[model samples]
Target chain A: MSAPAILEVDITRKSFAGRDGAAQLVLEDLRFRLAPREIVAVVGPSGCGKTTLLRLIDGLDHDFTGRIVWHATDRPRIGTVFQEPRLLPWRTVRQNLTLVAAGRDALADELLHALGLWPFRDAYPPQISLGMARRAAIARAFAIDPDLVLLDEPFVSLDPTMTERGRDVLLDAWRRRPTAALIVTHDMDDAAALADRVLLLSANPARIVADVAIPPDQRRAGPEAAHVLAQSLRQARAAETRPGGAISGSSGRR
Target chain B: MLPAASTVAGAMLHEAVAGPLLANLGITLARVVAAFTVAMVFGTALGIAMGVWRRLDLALDSWVTVLLNLPALVVIVLMYVWFGLNEWAAIAAVALNKLPSTAVTLREGARALDRGLEEMAESFRMGRWARLRHVVLPQLAPYLFAAARSGLAIIWKIVLVVELLGRSNGVGFQIESYFQLFDVTGILAYTLAFILVVQAIEWVLLQPLERRANRWRR
Candidate 1:
């Protein structure tokens, strides 16, 4: 069998109280595991509880009915890049990174330098563009050298050039020290490029509709391979949406 | 402006006006500083607590509303009556007048703090003090500055009124004494002195600090 899992998540059910005070389901019978030092991406459309899933894994939301077990001797330190840059508006870019950095001065500086943010180190969040702020946030996540890194749609709303640069920075950081990563994204290309395994989710009360594993060698095959993988995944997704697909909603259990 | 200049000039020229004006100015400035500091410190603390804690907000919101709507004159008169016209009574009265509004402003600031930042803090495992310094406080700085700005305006006036009503040595008390004797020049002199000092404080201190705090906004 594969190497022992580093994270085991078995979410039987998760729901929220709607405005009318009725219990509405959000996630159902979801089960997944990430191998040691593996990167997995969860792909779904907007409002498919992608963020909610990341929050649960990051231990920020404890209200869900499930178990997210970090299979380690000690609790793994977590670093999360949120949907928004989430930088302190009053603090400079360097200050924001230093605030969460785990005393790795050189690494923090290098991340800033690598991201082309060295010149704007003293600039506040509002003083920088959203793309730059997002880079600072990415730097903050890697500076800690966390045991687990969580990213929530970090490349959304950016132009293709910036998106490619962000992906490069993220992959470069992950390659340096292989850490367990759980990324949530809607983009098929990002999923193909960044994840060893890509899991798709259905609409509200989400369940894993498909799980496509990209071989370790194939994961490093550059943009052309990523495009081909994305196209195939798109076809699979479309086929599921069509009538009489093999997957049904009744058995959501893994 | 002409009336104020002439009154100040006349007071400076008149030997009898100089000694009392200097003494009263010192006393009034000290009172304003003390009352403003007290109001700002206590008001910000209570406001942040209320903003963060729902139960505390529910418990104290009505009391804040009552204090906000309460008259400064009534508070000063009541404090003087109860505390026997002492310095404590005067300072307490002024601070109480400004506290509720400061609290209200800061409460809004606290409520408006971004949850997204908070989640980032939590995920990074930032400690309480670090989160407060790096995340919460920066977000709340604008509100704190706003509260201090508006509160200072209200506070200085209340301090003067408190002196006029109860204390015996502040600019307000000197004005009262001049009022009894119908010395219009002396009265105008104290008012002008107070106005000039307040203007100096705004231009030299508050404006620079505000600029520093908001430099990041640009």
Candidate 2:
């Protein structure tokens, strides 16, 4: 038998209030499953509720409809990295990481060292550059040894060079712990570079528009594959915007 | 001119004025410290309660608003009338006056905490106390220190006013005595000494604490 699904989302639906005071459906009939150590990238236009989906998976949002089941005997701990590096302004990089580590001091330091952050461990968040701050945030998430990790545009603000470095660090860290991960991003390059499967959503009350499995070799190839994937994503998105298609219902809002 | 200057300086340093100045400074320091301690403990507790419980925030919002706006002198006078003109009454009045401000400041900080962090803590299966000590407390430290420093400074000045109006001893009493005697030199000496003490506190306590709190910010 195939490995059991570590996470399952069945017909999940979410809506919000529209300008006309009507209920605007944000996501509808969205279903997916992930096996252990799987990395799924969720791609969508702005305001497609990608972050909202992550929130629902992490149990931070309860206003949605459907069942999100974790197969683990116990509810697995979740670690999340937001678009912004949300390190505490009052704590050093090391202290911030340790706060979430919960007595895993050795593990915290090891992650920091692996991320090339050991030299600046004592530096406060503000003293560090934007890229460094993002690294620290990544280190903090890894320190917790979570069974599931969620990334919501975690590398949006980085430059090209920093983005490449961040992607490597994230992949390496994920490989070490081997947790199921769901990454939400607008950047096709990011989705193609890191994901085992790329899931696409349409704007406004989002629904699954496409789910493409990326070959293992392609993910490891990096930039060249990223560029090709970006073009394909653009073509797919354009097809989505056509008069009659899978994303037609939500196209008006987009 | 030199002889006149010497005479003024000599009079300002006179034993009668200097003795009371030192004693009153000690008394005032003690009162401020006591009042600040009370404010910190009670105010922080209240602030956390208000932050954590929406019902409590609704229930106590009006009361905090009233206390924050009430004139300090009126509160001091009421305390004197209600509890008698004693050290306990004076200290209590100063602390009560300072409490609302600290609570309001800290409440904002507590309320602004990231919900993600709290969820992360809960997902880890951390108990209530562990969550508080590990997650909540670290995030709350910067706000707590800020409230304490400002609250201390405000309470210190209020204590002096409370002492002057109600008490028989303290920096305020010395100032009153100097005023009655029309002793300008004596008044200046007491005022100068009190100013120096406040400056000393800023240097030794508030500045260092502020630095420590922001050390993580770089």
Candidate 3:
């Protein structure tokens, strides 16, 4: 018997209103699937629809055209850790987690401890440091034990050391629950470090331009593996820049 | 005549002024407390509803706007006629004067909340009650404190007006009596007492709550 598909997005297309009121496509004919516990990293330029894609997948954006199919036997619960910590300034870290954890204070406490936020549990969002706030948000996300996690630039604002710590915490938690995740990021290192498969998107009116699977052996090799993956990404970018092909078509050959 | 009058005023300020001033202060404080409680509860509920529901906001928008702009004197007079100049009527008038201000302030606060946090809450499968308690209420504290402080200040003044206009007791009525009798010392005593009450509210209530609310916002 085969494992079930945890998530599937079929031929998704999203557009926004342009400055002149013209329709600006952000994503075109996007398609993907995730098996149980699969971790996919999405990379693209700043204005590209990377966040849009994640929004579409998370069911936050229903204005787009496409189908997102969740195949788990039970309805998969979705959780997101956004670019900013986005914690309520008035809420203590513990209270923020309790919002979703409901009757699971123990789980929230454990997660907060794991994320190095136990001491700041009673502290409000504005009282904590940016890194601590982000960690709190991460803890809140994981405390729910979601079936699928959507992370949109979750570590974008952190310093190198903080980013590395955050990555470790996220990986540890992901390992524990083993949930599928779709992460949108601009950092190649982040993609290589955390993702099992790296999906590249084109500039605005984004479409998947490349999807490269990293072997388990390669994933264990650290920065050297990231450097190698970066090379593949450069080639993919080169192919994307080639004339006479729509950005979405670039992923076809991959 | 002036020397004897000054001596009489001084003695009057010491005895007759102090006791009534204190009693009236207590009465005014009680009225403010009651009015503020009613405003805070109903205002917050209404504000949250207005903030969260577009249709309800639109429906009630004109009503709130009109009430907010309505003259406090007119409301007080209407309440006196309708409710017969009782304590409840006075309290209700003060609360009504306060409600729209509280609701407007809280509504703005609710509208200013980050959608990202709301979405994060939803994605976690947070129930409605949990979301309100954790997500909504927490974010609402700053605004609530603000509205409470301003509403208290406003209600304190309104309560005095309500007392003076139709009621038999209160600092406002006492002041009116001094005005009619042309007793400057009595007037100054009540004014000083009311000022002290305002200062007490600032120091004892609002300052502490504001400090606590903003403590984590650093």
Candidate 4:
């Protein structure tokens, strides 16, 4: 909590033209920051500009206002697991990992083994199950050994068991690499299980409602603690929906 | 009169072994190979360029449409007349005829490329060559195969016309000479021999390659 922030996000206003030629605001006065090696989960309602925020940070969308500052010599190396797997369909699992590593990096092979994708190394995307494909995508993220990783709903469509497995592999890779991660998810359980902090967002024209931190001891307190934290997060977001209920960490400017 | 099937078969075997049938067929096949190579290579390059850049696509789109709808016979005659009946002219004419369709198919392929995958590649900052090899080319494989299949068929057909009109030693020329003599067996023999060669190519080369490239689809 005390380390200097590695990435500072201050978006004063971001919007795009609607279908009727009118501008629709998505993120307004939205601001957040990630310290070195921090893991933050952004939980928001559907279509609440969570993905848009990640896109802004990732430079996928440049139409947004304000700036994202990276406190480093060079732009931070990034590994992203998008909402979809986005694995190359024609490439084998191993080939997909090796592609971004600029040939074959040892980290690629090690991540493959750690992520339990080594056995499916030769399989193409269509040949593998959805869970495996998603895991492969995560492995590719870690293979680059980036300074920051962005995950947009890493387990959106998977069943509960697969979701847990996905989180397990993600955490495993993260522990080994220990880089900062910004995870955008709709599920608070996903946030509690994976992120050290949670950022709650309001509905349309999303603004940060609350940024809740999980205590270090409570995080180590296992599934019960995560469940209790998840419940509190839901309550905080629910409470922030009222007229005078915006919590701390809202409108983070400058 | 049309010759009997057995008689045509006998003539085909005899002509393949002992007549101008082999020599003429060889000439036509060479043109097919040359023109097919030129059309595929140039068409793919042009199509990818158009696919990647909207300005290039817009500028060249109408020109491609004109070429696509242009009559092959007209192009062949013009090439022969303008280029002075040279071998290069024949190849050029045939290649030009097939070029438009190949470019069109690849253009669509380039345009429909999976944007999500492209974003992934961009985020990873893949180099141009690596992106082409791992991301772009694989996605373009189906369209490339489509172009090659149609190009091979069309190039061979146009090569015969080029040979019949300008070049003097090909299956088309051989058929013309036999037409003057009114020899049905000779005509049938050369036609049958070429059909068999094309069939061999389709079975041996194209089908195998298409299967191998698309194996991942299964």
Candidate 5:
């Protein structure tokens, strides 16, 4: 049986103030519900307001219409990994985690070990490889022992080997402390690998066009096993755009 | 015409050995340090406030501008006139002179802070103190270092004027006495002593502090 809902995101509209002082709509009618420990990946075209949606859900931006309802009775602590590593360049890997989660040394030790960050625990962000830095950022988020985790293109801009390793690192982290997470990515292969459910979104004012669930056994089996499933996610999206021809009309292409 | 380099060096050595040069330097150094610390403390605090809050910026920015443009010598002269040439008045005048520039530099630093790191800090719900300690202060280090370096340079010069105008004893007092006697060598010697001390501070103190702060960077 499915678990009870942990978080509810119901954003009717979101916009930004344009140069001319007009409200430029970024995302419209974005509605989704996340169950406890459900690792969902949001896949959409680049600049489809994916980051905006994540920001709204992460409670970083409040200038949106509608509300995000958390089913959890108590305050739900949040952890997030942005497009950038966002690790404090001035602090060591260990201090980066501890700086945020003070007095939780034992948990920090576990996360550091799980992420294989002990060897460089005292290393600064600039000293480590991008892949290692990315892992540190993930571990930093999990260090807080958060109930909700949001990642925006966590593995983007990495080499193929790094990307694969990053996926396993995230899966390992989630396995240790399974929580409700929303990962925003444009790569369907990554979406297939890291997520239990893939929420397909349409371009421009992103809406949930299709919600495809990865089979239980197929989850986190590496990107190769789910390549076909991810491709199908793309084909289903294309099918949705077939009739309305949302893919057509480049008049507003900026 | 400028004094000969060797003549100035010889005169400086003579002063160092016999004259009140060393004692004067100690006094001047103390004043410079006092002014530097006071200015940095208030300037950094005010700068971060203005940078973080738009209302505070609008309110105090004009005053900072006025202070920034005011003549340092004029401020020192006025302080001596109002406060009666006391040591505290001297330090306060020098501190006030350097305070505005420090605030302005730090304000720019605060405004240009990394939004991504801030969001990361916020999403984790860090307390105000922790956020300032980690997310904010580290990013502002470069600016802080800069204000400090400039403050030292400016404060010492103003302190000299403060000494020259009303102080009983300091490098500036010695320089003034030499100027009156048309003793070019003595004036050059005092100038050389203070320059070397300032340079030593840069090498020994500020340089090490900067290295420590930037150790995390590549």
Candidate 6:
């Protein structure tokens, strides 16, 4: 049986004020629901308003047309890993986590150890490699013991080895104490490996193009197993774009 | 070199440590501290406010520019005329003169703050005080230190002018007194002592603080 619904998003549309004072359409009719401890991955082309959707859902942007509701007994605590590490340059790794989660030193210690960041807990962001910094950012977020976690391409641009290690750290952290997570990524392989549901977004004025659900067992076996599933999703998408294809020009719910 | 040695010798022979020289130096040092503190507090607050709020920044831009251009001497003389030779007035005048430049320097710092870090803080739901202590203030340290270093340089000079114009017992007033009596040795000695004190402060206080604040950068 599925878990209880934890988040509901119903953004009819979203736009930004352009330089010429005209409204630039960024997102449209974007709708999704997240279940408790479920992981959802949002995949889109660059500039297709993936970040905008995340911002709206994260409650950072309020200029959208619809509502985003978090369903919980108490206020849902949120933890986010931005595209950049966003670790405080002046703060040490431990302090960066501790600063946000004051009086939660034990939790922070556990997160550091889990992420292999314990040795560099005293190091500043600049002193660490990009991969380490990214790990630290993840550690800071998880240290908050949040009910909802957001990741915006946290492992992007890392070397292959770093990316694989980062993926493991993220999975391990989530497995220890799972929460409702929404990750925005362009990497279909990573998305397929990590997410229970993959929500594909269309190009600008972004709408929900597809919602593909991977079987639990397929996702459990890791990225190599999920790569075949991801390949089929991509081929299906390509076929939809072809003239008179089986999924021709539908652009709506599957 | 010869003249400096002779002047140093004369000052030692004439003005002992237990005399008016120490009293005057103490008074001047107190004024510098007072004016510097006031200027820094108000300037940094105003700068950060303006930087964060667009409308306030636009409204205050012209005012800051005017204060930045206003002469230190004019400000001191006007304060004396208006407030009538009080110590508060002297300190106020010096602080007023230093305020705008500090504001301008810090405004740039505020503008240059990383929005990414801010978003991170917000997503974590960090409270106002926590954000200020960790995210906001650390980002502004280099700027704050910059304002302080430049503001000190400006405040000390202005304080001397304020004292020279009205105050009875300070380095500036004593220098003027010796100027009239052709006591060149006394003037030289006070200047040298003040310079040494400034150097010591930079070494012991400002430099160390700057290094500590920017240790992460290293």
Fnat computed for model 3: 0.74
Cα lDDT of model 4 by residue, A1-254, tens digit? 68899999999989989999999999998888898778999987777888899988888888988999999836677899998999998888998998897654699999999999999999889999989999999999888888899999999989877887888899899988999999998888889888888888876778888888888776624456777877877777777667765333332211
lDDT of 2 at A71: 88
Spell out the clash pairs found in candidate 6.
none
The alpha-carbon lDDT assigned to residue B25 of candidate 5 equals: 98
Ranking by lDDT: 5, 4, 1, 6, 2, 3
TM-score (C-alpha) between model 1 and the true structure: 0.92
- Report clash pairs, candidate 3: A26-A206
- What RMSD, rounded to one decimal, does every model reach? 3.6, 4.3, 4.4, 3.6, 3.3, 3.2
Which digits, one per residue and each the tens of the lDDT, describe model 5 over residues A66-157?
99999864688788888889888988999989887767878888999999999999898999988899999999888888888899999888
Q: Candidate 5's error at B27, in angstroms?
A: 2.7
What's the best-to-worst order under DockQ? 6, 1, 5, 4, 3, 2
Instruction: List model 1 lDDT by residue over A1-254, tens digit each.
Output: 17899888899888999999999999888899988778898888777788889889888889888798877746787889887899988888988888888688788888888778899999988888888888888888888888788999999889888887788878877877678898998888898888899888887778888888887788957778887888887777767756745333331111
Question: Stretches of candidate 2 above 4 Å error?
Answer: A229-243, A248-254, B1-23, B40-66, B103-154, B177-184
| Model 5: fraction of the reference interface contacts it also forms | 0.97
Q: How much lDDT does candidate 3 score?
A: 0.79
Top DockQ prediction, candidate number: 6
Model 4 ranges with Cα > 4 A deviation:
A244-254, B52-55
Docking class of 5: medium
State how far residue A112 of model 4 sits from its true place (Å): 1.8
- Measured against the native two-chain assembly using Cα atoms, what DockQ does each of the candidate structures obtain, in the order listed? 0.81, 0.39, 0.57, 0.76, 0.80, 0.86
- Local error of candidate 1 at residue B46 (angstroms): 2.4
